[model samples]
Target: MSEEIKVQLTATPGEKPDSQKLGFGKYFTDHMFVMDYHKDKGWHDPRIVPYAPIVMDPAAMVFHYGQAVFEGMKAYLTDSGKVLLFRPDQNMQRLNCSNDRLGIPEIDGDFVIHAIKTLIEIDKSWIPTEKGTSLYIRPFIIATEPCLGVRSSYTYQLIVILSPVGAYYSGGLEPVKINVESDYTRAVRGGIGFAKAAGNYAASIKAQENAKKDGFSQVLWLDAIEKKYIEEVGSMNIFFKIGGKVITPAINGSILKGVTRSSVIALLQEWGVPVEERKLSIDEIFEASQQGLLEEVFGTGTAAVISPVGELHWKEHTMKINEGKIGELSQKLYDTITGLQSGNLPDTRNWTITF
Candidate 1:
């Protein structure tokens, strides 16, 4: 239960990758942050150690029962040579939400943020300064108790890793093609859909793989019950702009409340743009496209920040959004958010933390 974070610097640092070729989550820094939790001892021994594989028992609960949760965030090395994190506190808070759903013990979100800052300080050089590049931070918790019973593990591990990554999408802000998946459902209400649990992503890989095989960059998931209502994109929350009003699926119990999504909504509201959160249907979107009302479609997440959707293929019909080009609103949002992240724009909303 000691609050001090023990730091262990790597003796042989890994070679830095070329900034231009730094793809997302491909390269890891020299060190990582780790903490362990037990029902008796609680979370203790917070430390930063060399980046390496974690040794776990073959019968660990996370392997059999899948009691794992993770989060995605980024650290930007601004043009002013300042290290910045955009809404990291929100990510930590969501991590606890996931932990609650997965039956994992909740660590102090503030203390974890402090540990993250310390980890970043030790590996600040790993934060890329290139345009459209930043250090991607992944904080994950996994059940480590070596028991195979159908219950929550008594021991857990919380690990944070850093990777210097370029744009998540190879095309940067270029629009991407998406496939509407009706055959498979990502999650249902009263499930782990709202949490960033590992099982949710595991359940999605099949649908995403099928979409990729059909020449789509991602899959637009539908609700599990009826498979009619729009839920979200595979890795990002979705937004549709029809007749100049923005609409996104309301946060029911099944959608991941993305940090970037919230930020985008805030920005739109501050600019006096109309935004709505409600139950949206795929049929309604296709209808809007037919009527020339579906002006823009985009996805938001920590990885891409803003990804414009060019085309959506549902059943036999195809809906091309914004004429297969990034919408004005999408471009403006990308520019504004990236500007704020990189310190090019003023922090009017105080969304970023700098070191």
Candidate 2:
């Protein structure tokens, strides 16, 4: 049996129904889970408190140097009135991986899982039941020690917050147009790119904004050293299909090891799709597109699940993939993954943990 954690809830006053109209991450729940760690005391004083503003000193390490990491996952409400978490253990493991890279102390996986379950139980009503809607959970750790020096902090804070989100594709499952960023690099070898650190995302906002301004939805980043191989899209891991085989870039030191990406590879392999985890070059994909052999291209992450890529722009040249429409494989992968998540399909991989 899991020990129940205490919570102090304070509901938000005059909440709006407009959240349904706006999509995900626009609205937050009334409460949040928090825990603190110290060099001498370790993690202590865990609690679920009202969602409120946090005060930090100007010299806080997170403010000065941006030493923070975060994970994105979801909680689903099934038709049977049961709540489920999709592969939370994997997220916990990944969080530790990020912590190790950031020089933050590792946390016990079981404790973190228990904390999440407790928090969700206290805020169950905040979860939406509409199709393509779920509670988005963000778990993050940040260095909070108040100091001006450029080093890791001795004090750390971890928090979990929930947001009710609608479908990522409001206009339906339409594919996206992505611009290949050959000039700017999102991550480099021997860098903190593999971790879910704040700096990695901070460095990407400008590029993403530029891409959006140019009528592209996202930027597909290439390797830093050679700027040849494909790495990932803005916040998701990318996948390509050529000649009926699924190929994604290998998990080099620079690429983030997304849970959704790993799960997709596992699901595809189980369905007899030849999945390759190796270096995939932009040149190869462009050649395949020119030869009319590129069948599909999509990105995977917790936020969008699997977003199809309709077009690719590389260095003043643009190529349309699958005639600028969603591919069959993309739809199949989305349906299968969403089905399993929504409890409409069999939980073959035992990916869901019920509450």
Candidate 3:
């Protein structure tokens, strides 16, 4: 390991995938950024090396107790050959937030961004340039300490990898049907639900799989205690428009602080659209839909950017939002965010950084 980011070029690079059919996260770049940490010495020995499988102890804390955190981001290739990243700073910042929640040592957000940008530059040619494709950046930290105790690990490893991903959903920008989860809970108010912890996603697999079996694209979660108040939809933060007012769940301890969610909120507020972040209940959403006030519903996150919810199935009721069509707001948001990401729209908000 090197004290600084010492780059090791790979002897053989992978063949680039077809841009048109590059499904999500199937292809990876040749190099990755890695760093290690110890309790006595703190975080040290940062380096960029050829991507390879990591050997870990059987009793590694991450495998045993799941003390790990990760961040999801992307790099886009414009028609002019310019590479742009959408809010890399926010992703790094949120990674630290997840670290704090999971009892992992916080990382320097600046250093993480630098390592990510350098890795992207080294594999810049792997970025896809189809109608809807980009290089997916995944930065994660795992506890490497070989312990079985129910406490934080004393050692850690940080790794950043690049994947050439197409659409996160097969529908692309099409609206999706969501099934509300009734049995399982994603996270509790006092849990690591607000953080991007690995266990949070791991715990959601059963419910998500059930939803898929029932012919739904994703699952909508409610509060853990009462299990009635709206929380989130699968991996994304959800939003709705009722009577022309944009509303999303308030940033409670259970909701992950989404970068794209924040951007959408800011854009709506700046554009003078009535936007509110509060505890919105499913009953209220259904009432609004029944009364013809539910104008739109969408989910925001790094992977999909904007996923319109055309239909929602709760308990015994199925509500169609925006007549099962993509709402005007959803379309506009998808166009705007993806436009700025690809340099098709001017980044007036300074959210995109050209690399």
TM-score of every candidate relative to the true structure:
0.98, 0.97, 0.97
**Model 1 clash pairs?**
none
Q: After superposing candidate 1 on the true structure, give the runs of residues whose Cα lies further than 4 Å from its correct spot.
A: none
* Pairs that collide, model 3: none
Worst 10 residues of 2 by lDDT: 11-20
**Which ranges of candidate 2 are over 4 A from the true structure?**
1-4, 11-16
Give lDDT per model, in order. 0.92, 0.89, 0.91
Q: Write the per-residue lDDT of candidate 3 for residues 44-118, one digit (tens) a residue.
A: 988899999999999999998889899999999887887898998998889888998889998888888888888
Candidate structures ordered by TM-score, highest first: 1, 3, 2
Better of 1 and 3 by lDDT: 1
lDDT of 2 at 309: 97
**How displaced is residue 265 in candidate 2, in Å?**
0.4
Candidate 1 global CA lDDT score: 0.92
Write model 1 residue lDDT over 1-355, tens digit each, in one string: 4479989999999999998899879999999999999899999999999999999999999989999999998899877778898988899899999999999999898898888899999999999887788999999999999987899999999999999998766666789999999899889999999999999989999989988898999999998887889999977999999999999999999999999999999999999999999999998999999999999999998888889999999999999998899999999999999999888999989789999
Question: What's the true lDDT of residue 272 in model 3?
Answer: 95
